[model samples]
Structures are given as structure tokens and as C-alpha cells.
Target: MRLAWFSWLVRNFGGYGFSDGPLRAAIGAGAVLLTAFLVRITLHRHRPAAVAAAGLTCALGFGWLAFH
Candidate 1:
């Protein structure tokens, strides 16, 4: 499960270790920043196609995360 994987990650690389809340907040912030950067660049060049592709990618990513 995702929680198991996250725990493994924390154990391996979290140094003194981290509480889940702060770690999750940091990761979520990073994801949002990365998504915004990618969308800004792609949207400027590809317009409608970029938006569609981004939407599809997000849906697929969420589905995979939820099911796998």
C-alpha cells in the first residue's frame, strides 16, 4: 500500500525520521510547484492540446495511485 511505501521512504531517507503530516505537506507543495511549472511552459507552446494532455495525465496518475 501507499502508506507502506511512504514509511519505507521515511525510514530510508528521513534521517532522524519525520512525522507524516510535515512530510506530506512538503511533498504536496513540491508537486504543486512542479505541476505549475510544467503547465506554464507546455500551455504557452501547445494551448488546447497541452491542457487536454495534462488533464489526461492527471486522471491516469490518480487512477493508478488509487488502484495500484
Candidate 2:
């Protein structure tokens, strides 16, 4: 699952552009990172698992709905 998703991300957003897939993983990654930063700033604590989950969800959602 992880490898497939990784491949999809690289193949879509790396250099494909609109030929096959949308290059929106960059946007997704940025949004996810921004959300993580916001969470860290508001929570005042560092929990890697929680931040990872949030980022993963954001990335997946963006990929499925927006990036696809």
C-alpha cells in the first residue's frame, strides 16, 4: 500500500504534469505541512504520531479528491 501510494505520488507530481496525472501532490504536501505546523503551534507539544496521522489524512484526501 505504501509503496503503491509512493509510486503514485512520484509518478503524478514529480514530472508528469497533465499528461497523465495532476501535479497536485506538491500542493497537498504543502497543505499537510502547514496543517502540521499549525497543530504544533496550537498544541504546544510534539507528538510525531499525531502529526503524521494528520498529514497522512490531508495528503490522502487531497490526492483522492483534488489531485486525482
Task: Identify the candidate with maximal lDDT.
Answer: 2
Candidate 1 residue-wise lDDT, 5-66, digit = tens: 98876675434223346666466545655775587567877788777766666665544333
Q: Per-candidate TM vs. native?
A: 0.43, 0.38
Backbone-clash count (model 1): 0
**Which is the leading candidate under TM-score?**
1
Go through the candidates in order and give each one's C-alpha lDDT.
0.59, 0.60
Model 1 regions more than 4 Å off: 1-40
Candidate 2 lDDT, tens digit per residue, 1-68? 99999889667654433334445545655666677667655655657766666676666655554434
Clashes of 2: 0
